[model samples]
Target: MIKSKWTSEQLAWKIRRHGVEMTHLSGGSHLGAILSVADIIATLYTNVLNYDVKNPKWEGRDRFILSKGHAGASIYAALAECGFFDVEELKTHYQNGSRLSGHVSHHLPGVDFSTGSLGHGLSVAVGFAYALKKDGRKERSFVVLGDGECDEGSVWEAALFANHFRLNNLCAIVDHNHMQSLDFNENTLEIENFGEKWKTFGWNVIEIDGNNHQELKVAFKRVEEYTKDENHKPTIIIANTIKGFGIPFMENDILWHYRFPHDGWEYDCAVTALHQIKPEGVEDRYTPNSIENPVLPTEKDDINNDHTFSHTWNTTYPEQMRRVDAKSGTNEKVHNV
Candidate 1:
């Protein structure tokens, strides 16, 4: 594995900044998801995972999977920033015929598994962990999941299987952003006491602030030490995070879950908030013709009109907020936007 010059915090900032740009450039959704999980992804790539940029498929590499694949842009950004591929390829995300699909793709140089379906990634990670344990390999399997994704029965089944065999090499991180596709987890199927659910499945659980780098680092270290024991249970980190974190206006807002930062105030403000300069030449790029496809409309129409046929209602929870400093992009208290 090539050494990373940037610290985990620096890498995280880049991931959040790049994620905003990719979603803006490609008219992709899940900007909220990307923002919520960027820190976790960045921390893993910078501080934990081992891999070769030149040979992503190297056998000695630790396996990393993004179970919450809607936030695939963050992983792509992390890989690009780490030099797995040209960072320039990020601009092609979610565009016509681009390999960087809206969901995470195995076709990418560094991605271990292609995951769009929510509950299956844990299963795949479990398999990898089990195989490595049987082979007596030191490499570990790591997977990131979304809190809403826990609704799937398949995830629990995988959890049971992993614990049954004592797959201590597996590390799962859940981005508990509280809100899922339509509304808050409480409104949609609530999975309260999330950490306990994993504990009940017979896995070791560590709960921490998903956005805080210090907390994440300490949690990862604990995982490493725990796995060293001959008789150890699999570990899962329940990372509490605010949806739409970092961007001031978007923080904890469900609208961003499917809202792309189109060219306008939304795009300009988000880039500025991340302390990044907006990319040039995006105006000349091809945006999807929404009228031709009723399901996908322009961002303007997406905000103004309620196309119930799509079942996407604009639900704003501005009342629910996490104070993130715009300039630093950290979870620091700031005056109201």
Candidate 2:
């Protein structure tokens, strides 16, 4: 088990590091947008979504679709941190025959679906959520779309369908970094009032700083509560984020979106700056289990000491049975089951 909860700052550092590494390895761009969404992606995987690393295909697991596939580097970093795959494999990103392409690939273990083309993820999420609701399942579907991608008419069509179906289990997070491929969002194509647009489309909207973990958690909690009520409208979280959120020189710089870091000084400076920020702990929130097991055990024996003998016995018994079953069968079945 991961002993520490990843702070937004720590996550940003990792994302920046990974982005630099990926660009050096793959000679690609999109680092700025990738960095911008890193905190929200980290928050969803670490604190919000209910997913099992051992069971990536679990039916009850939440679904996360990355609509802006260009931001694949950040998602890859988050997945590696979450134990989906070996972090070293990130070096293969965008290389010939590597599954970690410039865009997200469904072939990846933790990726719920493949996406690269703009304006497609929300529709897929809407379909997934509608099906889950029809089957009376509790799984939630989340889609992250780029603000620039909103220009695609399909996105609005999907929004209309989501509202018509009243799929409250669906949540769409728009990465409003304000820059598209060529120029500023407003200068290229204006989406001046995104919040009102979503609201007008019949979605419950919550606008917040996407980089703030506490705020993201609160927004998601509200979404959860809204889903529980009889009211069944879809929810949209307009996470106002900055492009290249962590790198001092890259923040809000349009060049970073398309320019790959080539010089060692630029890369080193970004990494050094990112490491300067310390992890900020979540505030005013307490979980009974978290309190009971603060500072997670670094070893197996420590786990036994943290809890009573009876509790350890109860917990270890089922785990032992699971391990035995896992050893007795094919690895594929073990993973999928």
Query: Which one is best on lDDT?
Result: 1
- Expressed as tens digits, the lDDT of each residue in 1-337 for candidate 1 is 6466667777777777778778887788999899999889989988999999989899999998999999999999889889888988999999999989999999999998999899999999999999999999999999999999999999999999999999999999999999888778877887988888899999999999999989999999999998897579999999999888887767777788998887766776676666532223222112222122223335664343322223464344353355766798777433354
Candidate 2, 107-160: lDDT as tens digits: 988898888899999999999999999999888899999999999999999999
What TM-score should be assigned to candidate 1? Answer: 0.82
Candidate 2 clash total? 0
Clashing residue pairs in candidate 1, if any?
none
Best by TM-score: 1
Per-model TM against the reference: 0.82, 0.80
**CA lDDT, every prediction?**
0.84, 0.78
